[model samples]
Structures are given as C-alpha cells and as structure tokens.
Target chain A: MNFNTDFTPLTVDPDKIYDYSFSIIEEEMGEHSFTDDQWKVVRRVIHASADFELGRSVMFTPDAIEAGIQSILAGRHVIADVQMIESGSGRKRFQKHGGDLHCYIADPDVAKEAKEQNTTRAIISMQKAVRENEGGIYAIGNAPTALLELIRLIKEGVAKPDLIIGMPVGFVSAAESKAELAKLEGIPFITNVGRKGGSTVTVAALNAISILADERAKK
Target chain B: MNFNTDFTPLTVDPDKIYDYSFSIIEEEMGEHSFTDDQWKVVRRVIHASADFELGRSVMFTPDAIEAGIQSILAGRHVIADVQMIESGSGRKRFQKHGGDLHCYIADPDVAKEAKEQNTTRAIISMQKAVRENEGGIYAIGNAPTALLELIRLIKEGVAKPDLIIGMPVGFVSAAESKAELAKLEGIPFITNVGRKGGSTVTVAALNAISILADERAKK
Candidate 1:
C-alpha cells in the first residue's frame, strides 16, 4: 500500500485537527485575534520546521486545530498539502474533507513528478478545486511556484479567490516568495512580518479567528 | 557658545542620560570592550526607550570604549547611525557619527535652531572629520539621500572606505532604504536580517568585530 493508504487511519487525526482548527472561522472574518502564546506556537512551527508531521505533532494544539477549522467555515480557505521532496521537486495528493472549502494534500514528491505525465493532471485538479470554490480565502502552506501559478491564474480571471495566504515556512526564498504574493493587489491578505512568519504564524492567525468565532457563538 | 563647547563642560556624567535616545552604529572596524552587563544596558537603552535622555545615561565600560577606539585604529568604515530624538518634528534622528561619537543635547524648544544651524554644522563637521581621519570609519546612520550620495561618491572612486554596515532600525521606509544600501555590490557589508534588527543588532555586530580584534591584539 502507498503511504497515503498506509496512513489512512492517521487521516482521521488530521481531519479532527482540521475540524478543530477551523472551529471559529466565522470570528476571524471581522478582525485578527491571535494571542501572544498562539503567535509563539505559530512562529515556532513556521520558522523552524517544514515537515507537516513534525509541525503537526508539535505545533497543533486542540485549540489551534479547532481554530483552523473555524477559519474555513468563516469563508477563509486553507491549503496544507504540498511538501518539499527536494530542491525543486514536489507531489500532489488529494484529500476530501466533505466541505464547501476545498483542501488538497499535494504529494511530498510532486516537485520530482513535475516532469511526469501526472504533473499536468495535478495542476488541473488544483485549478479546478480553486475555481469550484470562489469568493473565499486560499491558504497555501508551503508551495511557492504552485501558489504563484494559482495566483497568476486567479489574477488572469481563470480562477477567483477572495484572499491568498502564502504561509511557506523556510529561509532564502520564503521572504521573497511572500513578497511576490503581496505584489498581487486585488485580494486582501495577511502575512507574518518578514522572515519571522512561518506556518505557525499562519495557523495562529486562523486559530485566533476560530477563538473569536467560538466566543461569539457562546454569546 | 558653540553647541559642543557649551555642552562639553557641563558637570554631568558622560555616561548619564542625555537628549539622544536610542542610537545604533554599525562599525566595520573598531575594538571596544564591554562587559556582558554593559552590553545588555546598551541594548536595552536602544531597543525599548525613544527618549534621548535615557540614551545619554548609557555609560560604556572602559573595555567598550577601547574596543570602539580600536575599530578606528584598524582599517574599517562605519556606515550607519540610528537614533531617536524627542524634540523635533522628526522623532528619529540618524546622522553620520564622526570619530567623536558623542551626543549634543539642546533645549527641546530650540530644535529648529539645532536643525538649521547646529545640526547642519555638526553634519558638515562630521563629514570633514571623516576626511581628516584617514583610517576611521565614516558612519552613515539612517539618512537615505545621504547614503545614496555616499554610494555615488564611492562608485565614482571619490570615497574608498573598507566596509559599509546599513543599520537603519525603524519601520518607515526601512525596506526601500536598506535595499539602496544592499544594492552596493562588491562591498563587504553586514546588516540585520530584517525588521527585527535595530540599533542593538547593528552595534552587536560591531561589538563582535571589536572583540575579535582585541583577541588578535593579545596574540
């Protein structure tokens, strides 16, 4: 069985994580609600680690997971599937969350597969996913070129998204990559200040939104 | 009385608080010895408070003073100065610090006079000092236009300095301003990673260089 199939049981945790993450999505629509502790967790994950397994294990608290889910429900889009396999290679994996919000877990080896027949199919799938879900935030965790292509497509009117959050957590190209995302003007977006921002910060912002939503629901 | 002359004789601790708040200087060559505590004191003064009086109160240990003096003795250049002032329309003040890296405090109400007459003369005098001190670092703290002029002079082969450290530590126009300094290729330079850098980081780098020089001298 492939890693995806072998890890099928683990997907339940990630699903729960997602549900928990986006639990307060509605509250994040009005304003940002990240506390200092949440910011610290987000910062740590984004700056130091790139592996989702490691980031998932260490950074994702129950609160963080729920907050992430809330963000999606509140019209924020979150994508966290692309993984770095090498300097310039990646893979795309598809996961169904059964929600209006589109999510994909691109293969960790997609970059290597970019030269293969499956590359076109993957890109097309992503494009379709984005197009099918318009007027919502698009959160890409660590896909630079892919995110860039997505943004270009959206800008060209091939697809439309309300917001694009580039939350790639790495050195060298990370800051430059986010700067490139910020250059796209039509959609409102938020990023960590300079190199300090990472996946953790991205999730923190979402978590803050979720917390706000939960509080509102309580009221 | 001349600003320097009038202020120099005042029975005040040269290390005590004065009118200049936080100041960041990037010295390419200098040997200043500072205790860990002293370094901490300097860092805190520059990072937290924007009051010049607090800056004036900062007293470097004998080692720190000597370290700074040694940088001048060696063949290195000081490229930037970042500081805060409370009295002027511009809350921040960045100027070229001559070998005489001392603060001249004037009455808050006399800011216009200081800007029009005293500060102008000080800048001119500092520039002259840079010319006279053949082996000393010519400091250029957060003056973007002046930094551009300096770059132009260097490129034209008029002013050949050993190194330039760009240490502007504020949010306003920092990215563009640093880009100007960083654009100078083929020159050995050190700067903070990004916005997190300020006077403290710049000076920290200088202090590190100073310690290295001191170790060499002991050899």
Candidate 2:
C-alpha cells in the first residue's frame, strides 16, 4: 500500500463524465434497431451497466416509448417493486409532472398481508397498487413474483398500467417472468430477454424515459 | 396480448425464493478463496447482480472484514456516495447497532460547494463527510471522483474512516479509482477490479458486513 498519492482523475465534472460516457456508448454499440426514442432508454441502460449485451437485449413493445412518455407527461405515478428503484429514480422529473414514486414492499400493511397470505410482499404490493394506483407506470426490478403478479392482474382486468418496465434479475423464474412480460400484448412494456436486469438498470430505464419526456416538453 | 391468464409463478413465497437463490449461488460459485465472512459479502454481491464474473472480482484488504465488523458493532455511521445506497441499505441493522446511513450528495450546501469549486458534488460530499463523519464507513459506488477524493483525503491524513467500500461503476475513471484504492496502505478497503460495480452492489456489500456484525453480536 504505497501512499505515494500522485493519481489525478480524468475530470471531476459530473456532466462531462456523463457526456463522455454517452459518446463511448454510441461508438461501441454499433447498429441497433431501436428508434431514437427507444434508443434513449437503451443507451442509458448501457451507460448504467457498461454492458452492451444487456443493453442490446432490451426489447420495447411497439408503444413502450409513447406510452411511457405520455404517462410521465400526464403526471401518472410510478410503482416500483423495491425501495432501490424508488430511491434511485429521478423523482424530480416525476414530481415535475405531478407524479410520485411509491414502493410498498416495506410497508407494514403489505408485510402483514404477505405473511397472512403466504405470498411475497412484491405480490401484495402489486395487489395494493391495483386498489391505490391506476394508470401509473409499473417498474418491477428486483422481484419476478411482482412482475408475474402484475401480469396476472393485467390478465384479470384488474390492473391497467400505462406502461410496465419489467426487468427482474435472479434465478428462480426471473427469465420466465420477463418472457411472460414480453409475450403479453396490448399493455406497453419494456423488458429484456435474459436475467441481467436489476434495480439499477430499471432506474436507468425510467430515468431515460423521463429525460425524453422532459426533452419533448421543452419543445 | 393473450388474456389466457393461467400463468402461476414457481413460488410466491419470498423466503423460499431467497433460500433457493442462495443455494444456486453457493453451488454455482464453487472454489472461492474468500473466508466465510468474505464469502458472505461476495455471495450477496453475486445475488444482487447475478453476475459471477463481477462477484469473483471482489478484493478485500487483510483487515477489511474485521474493520467493517468492528465499525458496525461500535455503531459507526455509514456515509454513502448516493441516495440509492443509503435507501437500499439495511438501516434496521445499523440502527440496532445505534448507527445510521447518510448521503450528502443531494444536500444544497454540498451542491453549492461543488459549484464554487468547479468539482462534482461527489467530491464535495466527501469533503463534507470528512468534516461531519469521522470514523464512519465510507461507501462509494457511483462516482470515481468521490472515491479518488476520499483516497486523496486518506493520504493527506485528513480523512480517517473505518472502512472504504469503493466500487463506482462507469467507463471513465471507475477502474482507475479502484486501482488507486487498492494501492493505499493501512486502510481497510473492499473493492473490485474493472468497471462493473454500482450503488446496488455497494449496498449489497455493506449489508453483508452489517449482517456479519449482527451475527457476531448475537454470539
């Protein structure tokens, strides 16, 4: 451990680093089918993970970008599967449109319901969203159960989200859940094919949508 | 969109999923050199990211785990680089030990300081941490500038933290900062090589240390 200390970093400006990162992503990620709007979200995901494969794996429904942009512009709230997504999301962007991000996984009532029903808090959270939130964006990042439950609710005609960003990462049905999400029609969705998505990448996807909405609003 | 609706998930039980995920990780992540305590931390990282390559790249100083446990047991607060790490951390565990997790990146004062100095809020946040948070665990996961600044403060003898968990993610300066942290002597640090870490993985690492500390306290 030599404390010689003569290591200067590139640039300390946050914005510069962000711009430089996007430049690198554009240069490295060649030839994609995503439209400019969809690419915004994919670029941010790649920027967040530095994984071009995961970024390229991202799939957006025909109306995903449009649905997300309209919902965000309309001030529709966001339902995150975990606290990490709620915390990491660009809340100010949501708030600027009169919306907020909510996560009920740690709520006492959700916990009590999960314990009583022998279900995950994520499942209970989606159920709670059905009653408390409508026409909001559903962001499922950490729990396959939550994504599956939301899909069930959508099938049952009880949950009608403006958009679903389902990107749960893990074994034990993570890939299956995303596959289910991708197969669903009518409701717009943004998901990936593999078990590579998590709260961080999900947050990036949401932030990208928000940025696009913000840009559109500026026009 | 097939409204067929008959897709039940593998299990709705959260604990079962957690257990099953760990079993898979244990079986798959065979032949590691980490001690039991270190494996506890690394396992959680693998669980969070589901990336075996990233998890295997974790490096810990000789005294890293012990320093973390002692700091946590002594109820030393944690200073996170971003809100995601602070929000995602197991606050109850820290509170049980009489400590808290804090992130000053969003503070107005820190923003002002960054603007005045033409530096990132991450750098200013570290400067603030030096003044307001001594002997606390410094968990940096999003900004290489913050990690580099902390390393500078450590070398200058102005910052004395119990542990430094530096794992910022990105293409620019992320790997270089961790490399510099690895070279620092007499500091208990946990980091990884390459550009594959972020707030989620850093939170996982901190939570693992807190779990270890809690387990030891029960003994």
lDDT of each model, Cα atoms only?
0.39, 0.88
- On a 0 to 1 DockQ scale, where is model 2? 0.70
Q: Tell me each candidate's i-RMS in Å.
A: 24.8, 1.1
Task: Pick out the ten consecutive residues of candidate 2 chain B with the lowest summed lDDT.
Answer: B1-10
Docking class of 2: medium
Q: What is the lDDT of candidate 1?
A: 0.39
lDDT of 1 by residue, A1-219 (tens): 122343323222323323322332222223434454444344333222222222232222234434444444564444432321110011111112222333443334443444453343234435655655645545554444446567668778876555455554332234455676667665555554333333323443444444444455467
Which run of 10 residues does model 1 chain A get worst, by summed lDDT? A86-95
When only chain A is evaluated, what TM-score does every model earn? 0.49, 0.94
User: Could you estimate the TM-score for every candidate?
Assistant: 0.30, 0.94
Give the distance in Å from residue A22's predicted Cα in candidate 1 to where it truly belongs: 20
